[model samples]
Target: MTTPENSTAPRPIKATGRFMLAHPAHIIAQGFGSGLSPVMPGTFGTLFAWLSYVVMTTRWPEIFTPLNWLVITAAGFVVGVWTCQVTGRHLRAPDHGSMVWDEIIAFWLVLVLVTPATLSSQFAAFLVFRFFDMVKPPPISYFDRHLKGGFGVMWDDIVAAFYTLLALALWRAI
Candidate 1:
């Protein structure tokens, strides 16, 4: 995967260790290759998270409880922190755009929290999430700028999820 001489797209994180499949960190940090897309990798990664969450819930309906989702989201965050750290070091890019575990796990949280909703509702959630993730509003922007390393990478998306969830809650109340 060679970048063109003048291509602005990010080269997929130094494909040295089994092309991002050999190591667990690389696989996760790359969002199972969803992050490898040259265009809107964050969007692709979040979509992957949405699809994955839907499939999981559909396949195992009993597993969609709030407690289960919280546990799963927490575990993903813990693992994401370590993997993001490793992958960032391996790529030598502190916050590579292609490293999208932040989007994947963060969006997973959104989908899980908003379960049992209509497709339109889900779409609205997705759009709101993408907007906050992309624009990085207020505290989100502050964390994205002020934090460092893997924590910084994941913090902004978590904040985005908060904003998205807040919006969805208000919409639900109306």
Candidate 2:
């Protein structure tokens, strides 16, 4: 597809470490380079989110409380909207697969809500979140198709996170 004459989107370019480092938005929206993975960039972004969550909470328990995590995730989501928008414009692909900040931030939301659990449970959460994200069931698919801009890019994953949490909650209740 060709960008319109009046489009603000830039000419599409390959996502590279050089390009990622060229702008703060690129760095953030690319999941700090995890999005550069040649294979399953979204999965890699989620992995980065899980590992970072573990490291931060474990290494700085005093500062990385659940309350703190709520704040961080909220801030991440807001920042992700802008970063993803800017990066999308630069890439000229509004929802380029390489832009995995949506995955990273969304999985961070999952981790925050399902924490204080065993590694096995966290892995289960990861699997479920990935399933919902990739399958894009119903409204998730709807938003992914109809929403535009950075918010559109990020919203579907938030829905996926909700699905994941709902599944986990049901599992726990059973």
Candidate 3:
């Protein structure tokens, strides 16, 4: 059956590059096309977060102070809420794997806490964060299953970031 033109029902979307560019929300929610990767789009989005965070902080060190990063990351989360919601509606999936803004913003938060370290340390953070995110142990898995809509899509990754931070803290203490 054909859906009504004005119906609020979400329609399945083919997440192509064309679709990614079709709307501003799509661009942001899709991690500027990094989410188009057929394999491990979330990892790609997190990589984009790492590279972009490094570039921005290195290129504009004065502006990307820890405080500024807090602000920027907070703003990104707020924006991701809206963009993910809108994009999710368009994609007909509350948390489409291709919508990686959650990963991007969440990883940005993770990196914000782990900077001023060696490249190896940063890579470790990447690996740990990816593991927590992919495995979704305990509370992360609980929230991921129960939470709904844009907030749900974005929040699980935040828990993964927390787990990453906790793991990093424990490693540092050891």
Better of 1 and 3 by TM-score: 3
What tens digits encode model 3's per-residue C-alpha lDDT throughout 1-174?
A: 555887776568878999888889999999999999999999999999989988998999999987899899899999999999999898888889999999988888888788456688889999999999999999999999999888999999999999998999899889
Q: 1-174 in candidate 2: lDDT tens per residue?
A: 555887675668888999999999999999999999999999999999999989998999999988898888889888989999999998888898889989988888888789456798889999999999999999999999999999999999999999999999999889
Off by over 4 Å in 1: 1-18
Each model's lDDT: 0.84, 0.91, 0.90
Model 3 residue runs over 4 Å out of place are 1-11
Model 1, span 49-154: residue lDDT tens:
8888778878887976657977888888888888888888878777887788999888878877784567887899899999999998899999999998888898
- Candidate rank order under TM-score: 2, 3, 1
Tell me the lDDT of candidate 3. Answer: 0.90
